[model samples]
Target chain A: MNPRKNGILCLLLVLMCGVLVLSGCGGGGAATPPATPPAGGSDEPAAGEPINVGLNLELTGSSAEFGLSGQNGMKLAFDKVNAEGGVLDGRMFNYIPADNKSEAGEATSATTRLVGENVVAILGPMTTAAVLGSIQLVTDNNIVLITPSGTNARLTVNEDGTLNPWIFRACFIDPFQGEVAANFAMDVLGAETAAIAYDIVGDYSGGLAASFKQTFEAAGKTVVREEQFSAGDTDFRPIIENIKTAGPDVIFVPAYYTDDGRFVLQARDAEVTVPILGGDGWGSGDMVGIAGAENMNNTFYVDFVYMDDPSLQDFVSEYQAAYNRAPDGFSVLGYESAMMLVEAVKNAGGTDPEALRSALENLGEFTGISGTMTFDPETHNPAKTAVILESVDGVKEFKQIVEPK
Target chain B: MRWTKYLIWLAAAGAFYALTLALSGAGFISRFMLMTMVQICIYIIMALGLNLITGFTGQLSIGHAGFMSIGAYAAGFLASTYGGRVSAALTEALGGAGGAAVYYIFILATLAAGAFVAAAFGVLLGLPTLRLRGDYLAIATIGFGEIVRIVLLNTKALGASSGLPVKNSVGWTTAYWLMLLSVVLIYNFVNSSHGRACISIRENEIAAETMGINTTKYKVMAFALGAGLAGLAGGIYANHMYLIHPNSFNFLKSFEILVMVVLGGLGSITGCILGAVVMTVMNNALSAFPEMRMIVISVLLVVMMIFRPNGLMGTTELRLPFRRKAAGGKEDVTHGL
Candidate 1:
């Protein structure tokens, strides 16, 4: 080889070495689809191996706490299943979790890599935007996507009045929660005028805001102002300054815990003393820590059933015993989602996703930790009541459960 | 010899295109893979352009992606609104060849707009900072890239904070072809006479000036040309996904493109392509194991810097073995096609 050729060969050699090593470490064990009957079926494994499940959660970055909590919750279920001698004929379940870092693009990237790994089923992504990016990939691959927390209403609905069978959520969609807040604002608080502020960049926040707006307007409440902010925006002073002039009875902020919590504090700091309303993104205890107790006072939001509910003392103890921490809304949803998957597997009498999906479609009157649930065929969303909670003393205390209309 | 190289090039190109087409149809090609490959192509194009400046003409650029953002948004607005209309009009205007003409027009406009916008940005950013060298130029370019991203992030007309959604009508075939054609044109251009001129500037700017090479003209030309390519990549990318989120084209993205150039060796076009592909594959494959990904890329970069800092395939083209019948002397000079 000529000297120039040697130089080029060396460069190619270096890159190829990296490529070879990276590619070699890339392959993981194949997922074994579960073999047991569906939830209502006989207790016998009817088929092959357990399924490989993929999860893309924001285990780091802005939503790290939520992601970690959800993963732990899912892990609890995985442990229980494996300990009991696995799902579907002793075929063990494999759960792989990838961190999305709370970015939609990263979440999608993670989902792609997971698909390459050939996971049979996916249980994620925590954020709605993340879910949106992953849905096409999952659906195109004919794999089932069971998002434990994604609540955007559009996920379930197509342009036509049919269901997106490939996609299912263990958690409640935004419309119900948004409506619950709307009712609380109009009927409970008797607030005639409400101003809405939410992070425009997020599909989750924006979708929930739309629901709240639609519900509030239907109830004949006058909405004074609608303001938007971007994610990673620290200063809410500008939005707050604008909101102060609007002077609504209450300001609805359907945003993530980080932004919403800080925004709440900023609103108070700016002397815009009106009560703040929010959605499920305000569920975590971390919000109080991030925004301070004084900032979060008088702020109310809708969320999943309380983790510390006395009625579910046994469940709470089991969760705490398993995870060594008190559960949050994500924990419940994660646990319930795993259980829901198990139920479908049992009902189908096999680990086959197609059969499980069929069973899921026909699923009725199933009770879980979240609440009793039913999945309508047209929209894969499960029906459940939204619980309104006030951030009293910087802690979420359940006010009332608004049953589905 | 030229024929043989062309034949080899054609075969390789065919294989690559076919492979991409097949991969695009694979059930496992998730959103991440699709987007990553798209982004990698964008970076490769941008790096190739910047290579002409910094690598080939000895002028550094840290704001390559900024020019890309401009091209992206510009072509994005056109493709989202006008691509179809123009296609319709061209079909009517050019009789049976209207669709083809519209496509050509779209490509031409996108490339032209990208070049025009990038040249403007290059001039705006370069004019003030031309006197700077090395670290200073890098800092200025990096600052300019950040400013571009921030401006895009804040601008309401550019979809505000949410960033724009890709109009969602992109065909995979069109994207793949665009990338392929770009690589070929760039490869050819880099190996041409002008390419030698650019390389001469890189080797000794003062010497080239002493030889009446008009160094400033070449430097400016290199920056403008590089900016144009970056713009073209951005435009295609914007149309490819039908989305333009400003954050996606930030300083970090600029650095990633720079990494492609640096990792590939300064003046090596072949190195850049290989590096782009390697980086793209690594990003898609290692994302599953997130912790390992950062460590892996970091170690790879470190090892490359230590062992083969010039890059993989630096200034070398891949060639097949052949014979000169009469002489019988072994000769394997790989010419970049």
Candidate 2:
């Protein structure tokens, strides 16, 4: 063959291979229309076409664990609804999951692809950075986006409290979690003074730490020391020593499990055990593995849901049986978000985005694994109870539930 | 024969533009594909700029994304704050033709502003760093990139880490034409006398200086021009994406653009365009399978490098069979470099 022809052939072969691979991976399993008629004849709404929903999550990056668990939880909820004859009187819910890979650009592209698929609603791109990256697209298209774990207060509402009509989340915002932790530290633990060690570069950590400090101080508690560290910091001994010097009754580390675990280990190794406190960022199982069982004992963090809660026992057991591990805060929130969206779709009686959005806006007091959820009309954030969990012998033991004011 | 060639080129350009307009308007192309096309256009502009500096001029700048970020933020801020009023006023004053005319004018102004500001930064960064060689210059540029990111991250007016959301000012049609214009302009520049001087500097800096090339001025000029083009890309990107974040223009992004320039073939305009399109398509295509996307892309890069070390074009231009040669012997000067 001529060299030019060979080159063209090679290019064509590669192009064909790429298209095959993309098409193979892009097919989200088709949803079959219901064949059977409703058993409850009279009041049953007519069975319609299946509803297409999109799930955008971080499946293979630093936040993969959260994304995977969220996927499992969402799938479980979806399966459960399908088994119960589906929502909208038999219109099955079909979820198309895309991996954001925990990058902002990826999040935008993934969400855009999902939008292209004509989904009625999008479930999650779990982290705050990913959520913010895709929020503009969602808002511009007027698509309903219900993130499972994005907790930045500025997400659903602007800083000045103007509502973003298209955005909502299942998990409580950072300020709420921060306030709950502060209240728990001051009232329950009887802590007079507190110190904070936060990751300055992280939106979640910085925002949570600030809210905690502000609330703690407003309640007549002294925040003795505030130390900062960016992500990828290896040494926390110096910061721990500084906190020890200030001698606060409690120390708040508003960071993810990776950093929190190292801080816990380094703090304990230094023998500076003043009851450590944090937010939902410390809910990952990696925390126990990183900080050892002994080091993790007595550490407390506020979270959206606890797997051990009696109300969530069925889900917890089912999740363990399926994934062979106990579900974490992210999983529970994911399950709740999916369930909430399903309920909204059922209530709205259609898959239209505007109808589903209004249904969500007026979602009053719905009971789930994560307490009662009622989205505030002004800000699309749900008002729900946050549970304080203490690490006892490497186990997440539910301590107390703080109800919203 | 020359007129026939020109007519063919014009017809091809017209057909391409019409296709883009039809696809975008008819909703035949998915939003995902449209977004990907916009990204490809932006990356092509950016890679072309980088190719001019690193490929043609032998200046290794690892921080081109820094200039892009500056342009993105500058344009994003302007569009967010004042674009609506200006566009609205133009639409009112111009009557029927005003809307499109205003859109073109506004987009062009923002892109030009972004390019100018980025060029200014380029001059600021290039003046001192152009004195240094290779690794030192790379480090200096990287530091400049980091400085831009840090400044944007801290500056509340630029939305800090939360990011600034610009109005969706430009569509795929506008972006497509702008990118094509940039490619043509850069192609023409690469064939100019100044371009030959830049290439000579790349071949041997000391020799070029001895040959009265004024190496420093050419180097700085190439750097500034490259940065200005990058800024133009950033402006379109911000307006198209409707949002800009400091994190979007970090080291990883710069590395990605570098990969395109290297993968396409150094000192090759056609190569840069090819590389940009292929990479952008591959990225979008493989995104669905997140687990193996990175691995697949890395393996492909490795294979391509092994097969064609100099890249797909290897400093060679792809010429049409019907085109006549240039009047002078100017083409010979570009071959050795």
Candidate 3:
């Protein structure tokens, strides 16, 4: 190409990109009025304005299964609330979801963008590491954030032992889930020794593994083996071989369904027929599908609620009807997140951020698919029961329940 | 004539900064929008750095993001641990604006230290892969980047996979100035005799060697300089985002920087700037439409590659009225864009 043509092409490239950026940024807040300034009085919105709820989720990368399910659940709750004449003086909640692309940096960017959209409160970013990335942003913005599935204990509590004030989660913290898994393995499975393999790279997995080790050892049990695997490692046969040789009565793999599913399959393939226990990371519907039900006979994991519970049957059906798919643990947590946040908004009587925050800080019992739970006033994590489910005939059957003190 | 060029650049920078402030003041640029601007500047610095190594020089270093990760972690550690004390000390000594300026200067120094470390690694990487060429060199660089990422992933003090928080007080203006400096320095470097040697190597390494250019020395120099620039960008980026993760500087990020260098034209400084801006803008713009964003971007890249295989600028520099005439005021045939 000639120099003139190249110049023209470069100019065209710049023009095209420039126009796109303008169009992208300019498509903001034209249809709805700006966030109402906090004016002490609780009054109706003049134009039926929306209570914009921002969602920063991992919708398109690793652990996307969690984010997409959580987003869908939140959408269903919003649709139901909108159908019921809305909340906070009949103002519908306009849910704005921003995909974090399953990266910590992208999570921060997504949260920053969502916070700029005049959202009343932000929810989600399903994984713990992604939640950690966005916590500082929400703290800086003085906006409330409720992650649907992120259960890292440090998210709501800082290293200095102070409450983060703005960050909360619908699910219980990792330690609690860890304790439940440990208790089930010890009491239900009658295991004296456990072998553990965890994802070293995941905040959720690492924290959960540590918590399980502590809880199990505190209960006078032995941890025979401890193996570490990074997030995307597919070779679990070596780790499984080590765990088998360690002669532990049960194996605890507190990793995500993506990694743990293959580990279970490999362990079974190696003829290590001991019971395998796991944390909430294995609570996805896709988990059993990965390990295959025949190989998952003695495999069990802690979850927020059971899908086939009589109490959650309505939510399960409603979710399936809405999305044409079964609800996972993240979906249930996300539904409860929306339900609790909307209830708080209604109680606060306005979309004022401070009022909404205080209302969320004092959220009462929210009985939904995730079982009855109320946010702890100190830590902002819900005090809820964790259920253990076993793979039974190609389905997750409720095996046991571990209630929080 | 030199003063005119310098004056024009300063004026342009001032105008751009003022426009940003004006736009933000008028509510056109939100916090997120300004954040995007900072990111764009950061990426421009990085892309320009890669352009120097792979574009101006014949060395195709694919481990640019590895250098970036090193700089980011170094800056992150410094800012989070000592940034407060250093800023306080500077402010105590200078007070107010002077103190703030000095604090920013201290941040730049930390960034420079990061660049130094990254350059040291670049030289180390270069020594081992000196004889390798083309795809073999690319594979080696890719392995180097992966090793850096994996190390960062496993380092507990650096927050492991949880990511490190950078508590530096830097912002868009810092990024803009740093990027401007990078572009100016790289532009000057590309015009020097050393740059001509590098370009000759790009054309024909054997011919360049026959012409008495120390191929080994120049190759290592190119890697060091390019890595240092990327390190500078990484420091600013970590400060801007306030968090840095190993995943942020993965192989995909390296490939993205390489794409910017290739798409902007293999040997054009001005083209790299354009490429960075376009790519970052396209990413942000398409965020408003998530479903079709990937499809659109892939289509654009494929079309651009097919239509302009030499790239958007094709070895041409952006023609400016204030730019000094090439050498003895005769019309230059090399650059006409």
Q: Write the per-residue lDDT of candidate 1 for residues A1-405, one digit (tens) a residue.
A: 676666756755656766675556433422333333469976644444556678788776657777877888788887788899876677566787888766655666677667765666777877665676666667667777878887877676754665777888887887777778888988888898999988866456777778889988887888888899877789989888888898899999988787887898888888887788988887875788887887777888898787556766776788889768788888878877777777776788765567777777677767887678887776888888678887778777778787765
> What DockQ would candidate 1 receive versus the native complex?
0.28
Ranking, TM-score, top scorer first: 3, 2, 1
Q: Rate the local accuracy (lDDT) of all candidates.
A: 0.73, 0.84, 0.83
Q: Against the true structure, whose DockQ is highest?
A: 3
Candidate 2 local lDDT, A1-405, one digit each (tens): 764454455456556766776566445322333322367764433565667788999998768988998999999999889888887657888888899877666788899988887777899988887888787888877789999998888889877868889898898888888888888899999999999999876578888888899999999999999999877688999999899999999999989888889999999999988899988888875789999999988899988887777888888898988889878888898899998898898788776668889998888788877678777867888888888999999988989988888
What would the per-residue lDDT of candidate 3 be over residues B1-337, giving only the tens digit for each residue?
Answer: 5576678778988998999989899987888888888888988989888988898776778888999999888887888888889878888988988988888777888888888888888888887796788889989999999999999989989988778987637788888888888887887777778877878878899999999999888888888889888888888878878678898899989988988877788889878888888788777666646666678778878987887887788787777643544334554333522
Error of 1 at A185 (Å): 3.1
Q: Candidate 3 at residue B18, lDDT?
A: 93
| TM-score-superior candidate, 1 or 3 | 3
The Cα error of candidate 3 at residue A329, in Å, is 1.0
Residue B274 shift from truth in candidate 1, angstroms: 3.3
TM-scores, each model vs. reference? 0.78, 0.91, 0.95
Interface Cα RMSD per model, in Å? 4.1, 2.4, 1.7
Chain A TM-score relative to the true structure, per candidate: 0.85, 0.92, 0.93
